[model samples]
Target: MAGTAGSGSSPLSAGGDGDDSLYPIAVLIDELRNEDVQLRLNSIKKLSTIALALGVERTRTELLPFLTDTIYDEDEVLLALAEQLGNFTGLVGGPDFAHCLLDSVRLLAVEACVSIAQLLSQDDVEVLVMPTLRQAAEDKSWRVRYMVADKFSELQKAVGPKITLNDLIPAFQNLLKDCEAEVRAAAAHKVKELCENLPSEDRETIIMNQILPYIKELVSDTNQHVKTALASVIMGLSTILGKENTIEHLLPLFLAQLKDECPEVRLNIISNLDCVNEVIGIRQLSQSLLPAIVELAEDAKWRVRLAIIEYMPLLAGQLGMEFFDEKLNSLCMAWLVDHVYAIREAATNNLMKLVQKFGTEWAQNTIVPKVLVMANDPNYLHRMTTLFCINALSEACGREITTKQMLPIVLKMAGDQVANVRFNVAKSLQKIGPLLDTDALQGEVKLVLQKLGQDEDMDVKYFAQEAISVLALA
Candidate 1:
């Protein structure tokens, strides 16, 4: 056989794409020995890939010593070298490496946690990670605290049943009070994750003991980012705590947020409560959050209302038909004719869910005729909204209404002037296709089908073909 190795070529270069084993590993390892900081940094990155790909023992013996020397290097390249080296060490040693690096990884874990948080992976979280992270949580640097939480996402998986709340809670409780808003937010999120994996019995205690007292401060956090993080943390708590606990402990805080001065904070708060009634099994939400949801339905800022609208169905479902009858009909009706096309679209989408729950008489007599008039509106988006409403209505109550009443408009829209509008029509048609008996409306329906099947836009054509198949029209 020919000689296995190439002469005078580094393994990485000679390995064909520089990845083969034949290349000289010694040459690259020597680059790490160079005094020039940039070259040393470059060698560090290449070595990290090798260490991760090769083995930790080799990396420990080789790559780790450089980190101690470069740990305080002010050059960004050297700082980066220190960071990846920590990640490599984190991966190899899991929690076990904490003793070896001592304050080196500890200091790095605290100082660069957020910026480098993403680098920590599941393998790094073994029993060793928590003790190290718990220590870093007390660092003077709040970023370390924040990064500790960001890295907590990995720990959520790695944390074993053997680990106790006592082991985890101390670190999170300490960080929750950190002066830095980002640190507090991150800490709140970690507590949320911790409760998620905890047995349900302990969830309430953890939230009460670890997460709740901080709520007022978090809600009132001057920083928008902190408020946002708290809002998410609150939602995470609800998932693990069960609906009843959510209602008693969390709902009030969420409700108060509806009136918050910051639109984003208000949006985050009320948005959580938007569909919460169903999740929590409480009719009070209909009585309480309904007004906020409806008010947000037509909010001046489109995004805020849109967030509320996305969750409207769950709220409506929780509230039930009687609730809409008593509280929501008027509000949804008012939004049906709102000036903004998106508001109208959202209003109509929610209204369609109502028709599904309530019955066709309510939709056909109360909602359909109004939507039909809007379907012919001059603004294309309004027309599209009208089409969206029709499709939703058909899915909800189309079986009850005569196809002649619904199909004429749907068929017309499948060939609308705008490509996107036509696409929506195709999607709506795809959904309703199974309910349609193609032979029933042969002439007019076939024309729409033909256009969709041959639509100039490839995406439109693809969906149209699917819609046709779903209808058995092909």
Candidate 2:
């Protein structure tokens, strides 16, 4: 009798003391077929309440089919139906009949189901949530499988270790190799998080035996986005697996990814070098690392180049001055004159960090001269970069080096043809002033700032006067 519902009225309309309370259910059912989209969506959202009033058997026979029929409703309505039905397994005669509501979750509602799976009994989770997840993982639509992959880490935590190992692992491998690039990319992105959440006793074994081969496959995935996604997290496995396994298994994948055709994939590998360096040491990595690093430092993408410059001090400490000068030192200096202002700015800071790492004497011998020579570059921007470099290097290089090696170049640049160079030179003196001895500040720096204070350019003279105030050289 209740099966004849959704025609026009709630089944409770027949006979009940609660008919007055159930009047809203009739209105909700009536609204389910309403032409207005939000009305139908609102009705779908309260579906669990309607099912509760209708009782278990009627919910199964009436509500399930009505939702199935309304699958063609507006996407928002269907999305709401998907969310409501995920929690409906309990309302629809419990776990045995959870299967009748399967299409909603397997297709459009996978995320909500993961949240509800926690509320199920173990038997129900295996019976209801696991099978639904298993099928969703293999669903015909890439979007469904993608939903499963995106939430795979959350699903792993929900199902506990035994189910995750038995059911989710095999499904996960298929997802990582999914024919659609989007699904594979989603799975590739979860590799670190999935490995991280695996049971501690089995975490290493699972990553090495089960997860890694697919990860290796992903490292060369024909899709750049997949490789890029994997590159972002793959270095993380080094910490999870420990040094020996990382050196043996992961190092090769990292080296390969470092040379990946896509700049983002290559950039991702470079950015996370510290992850591997902490585990196996960077000297052992230097052979392959240097070439890929050099290639990325000069990469056509400015962001890629920027990532390498940021990582230079870490690379410098790991490889040490001998190897760094032999290989990477020029790459650091090359960045100072890089066409992109952001790159050049990072390069200037990089010199300061390098001076801190390698000390002032080596900077005098190595970095200081190159920065000083840039003052004479044909491009006025490079001359400005020289002043930027001095500002950064002053704190690290100290008073002797700032006054002796660095200050003369800054003072000389004050007379440059470009007002921008002159203004930055004034800013640089204010920055480096505290680093200079009183004799240098009073005699040389004061005179140069006084000369710059009278410049025709407003910006140059404003900064020149500001520098005099900040340094108290007025």
Candidate 3:
């Protein structure tokens, strides 16, 4: 066999001509096992030449198994073999012989296993593919376990309902609790998908009785990534499980994640609040909503705090004006002067949405005074934030509030010491001009623009002149 394998006369080795004729299969085999990595890599690159000389049957029986054994070789050698695989189709006698190569294709082997299982007879799948996947699901490598967990829904689909309920469900249970965090995260992400794809006949029973228990464990999984992945899609289960099951089984888990230490996890849960709201109603949701609100509102990450501020109007609308004033209104005001500019800006936009939700009276009596009082704030950024709020609020507050309530602040800031603040005041005046009646636009607004247009700073003067032209007060 070694003598027959050593021949290099095969047609597939034609390009080598006389060059690699010196490197026969027997010599290459020795080199593949050679202590030197460069020599092994050279042998791996010439893999198809060796396969051609060995013929299809021997390549399947002998060559592929050898490559599989040596897969743990240097990364470069493995990469060389991988690059050679796409060209191996005819060398391995085409697609029918492709499965022989599947075991060697580790990168996408999990998906390949499920795909191949679909084409085989059910008896073969039960007897053959099931055992291989079961082994892969518990493989010592976390990567292997992750792939099994990641592709599990597709595997369940290919194997039919009975086998899935009997075999894959138990395997999925182990995967969801796999010791590796990556494996658990992968499994956690698949929880809803796997449940959704379960046979309609027994899905609810399987989820309520079998899957929900592990999901409960996963929701509190120590790894943030796992919890984040779960939170992103877990709410979809509300409709599937119905209002009763969601309230009894999942709502606590949802609220727990909303207060999770991880910002991404909290954001994901908040993003899906509508799903839970539809299932449980706003009155029931409000009971747990405030704690989640306070938790996120005070998050150390500005982006997280900014996210909660963006949700305030919707929260305020559902919780109503009285509850908002008591619970959430202070948080919104605090955000107007938040240390982060992005938070202050989002807070400005949030007020517009709230005014739109609750009307101009809410803006005037509830929010307008608090926002306007920031003109006296000692910090310039807070003072600037006051102007930004005026810009955002002017349109929503309408002619009466714009002319009487908010317009006085813009005119006062136009004489301020800071050029940036003066320039922003010019911008605010222009933004609110259309919202004002002709008298205010041509009177107090025109005087502020004329004073700012002659200011020492170029930016303040430029913006002031632009506002004059824009408001047609020139």
Candidate 4:
């Protein structure tokens, strides 16, 4: 039994043996000082993995100083040093070991520059990593500086609120203007994070003076990616601000994106309206955002139109029926006939809400005729929504519209190309059964229920059975 277990632990086997190997540890420690960069690196990696598996405390008493020294050894060996330090520092060294750890971090943070920042980030061990990070935020290398901006973000979460905002805030502000676009992009994302959780007063001050100006400058950045990042930050801040008690200062920036050259940016800008309305007042929505919403309602991009549909109800509350009188009502009506199934579907749902809000006059004037046309659409989804829309419109207008106008259209859709339509149309006719004074279309309605009762989809089959049961009760 002992020999069988030992066989599984053999290093010569491709599979990892479960047995402890003490020989590799001593060999790697000796190779750590090797002049050959590759030999030292491979040795350091082996030792680091051993330390990770064994314990950092076990490795630290022997390996800490050597890892620190390697950061300045040469660029070729720096990566090896960084990887080892990441593993070593992350271990449970505690406060008593802070001096050796802090000293090593200083060299990486200030002098070794870029390589050290990568080390600090790679390990991201808050206890072993932050002191070096705090110092390196002042590094002379733009690459090092950019890296610090990123590490500060990760460390801030790990370190909690211990590091002063004063230390990180300026570094990020400077990074926002870095000559490298990649650095600028990274800094923008970091700054956005910082602003989110920064103490409320501090965040407000930064928004008023620092962040807002930086965003305006960054929004027009020649780098489209940077502009996109800035746009996202603006949108996030707008949402945060929209919920904040004090929002007078943030509204202008939120509104500016409505005209952004990028359609996506414009869409994000509009999305913040509800938040803004929640914070400021509905009047700001009615007065400031109406035209942009109208323009977006007709947007060539289906996504942008979808966004408009999402916000239209909010705007309607502020601007009232006058806003949708010609602009929104007519646009959705036209969309009901759209070739895109999603657009047609969205139009049907929104029209249901619209009829519910404005009643039959609005449905008759704006939606009823178009939805009736869609009852025959080729797209299965479109046909389903069209039938659902007629049912919804009848409910919105009461049974009078069902008896007077919609029953024939509902019966016609009972044989729709899609199964859901066949089910829903039958179900919709049953809802109007008690309300129908005459049996003018009673035979057609019976045929719909008969066909639906045998539908393959269980939902259709059940609703069809219910429709038949209701007809029998009548």
Higher-ranked by TM-score: 2 or 3 = 2
Model 1 TM-score relative to the real fold = 0.64
What TM-score against the true fold does each predicted structure earn? 0.64, 0.84, 0.79, 0.63
State the lDDT of candidate 4 residue by residue for 1-474, as single tens digits: 001222222222232334447556645655655666677667656755656654655445534544444334554455445444544445635434433444543334433232233444333434454556655655555556666666556545544443435455666677788788877877777666777867776667666576667766776787866766666666556555544523455555555667666776776666555556666665555566667667777778887777777666655655568656745667767776666677776776777777767778877766677677766767776776766677556767666676667887787776666777777777787776766654543566666777777877788888888877876733
- Residues 377-430, model 3: lDDT tens digits: 888899999989888988888888888888898898877888899999999888
List model 1 lDDT by residue over 1-474, tens digit each.
111222222223334445556244556555655556676567657765666654665455434543443234433544455456455545555545543443334354432332233343434443335556666667666655566666665544445444446555666666677788788777666656666776766667776866688776677778777777777656656666667777787777776666565677766666565446446655766655566666766677877767776666665666666665676667676676667777777787788777767788877777787777776777787787777777677877765463767777787777677887887777777666666775643556556766887988887888777777776667
Report lDDT per candidate. Answer: 0.62, 0.83, 0.80, 0.61
Clash tally, candidates in order: 4, 0, 0, 1
Alpha carbon lDDT at 276, candidate 1 = 60
Q: Where in model 2 is the C-alpha error above 4 Å?
A: 1-5, 8-18, 21-26, 46-76, 85-106, 120-122, 199-209, 358-365, 456-459, 472-474
Cα lDDT of candidate 1 equals: 0.62
Model 3 residue runs over 4 Å out of place are 1-108, 314-326, 358-365, 376-380, 417-419, 456-459
Model 2 poorest ten-residue lDDT run: 1-10
Model 4 error, position 3 (Å): 39
Please report the TM-score between candidate 2 and the true structure: 0.84
lDDT (C-alpha) at residue 351 in model 3: 88
Worst 10 residues of 1 by lDDT: 1-10
Ranking by lDDT: 2, 3, 1, 4
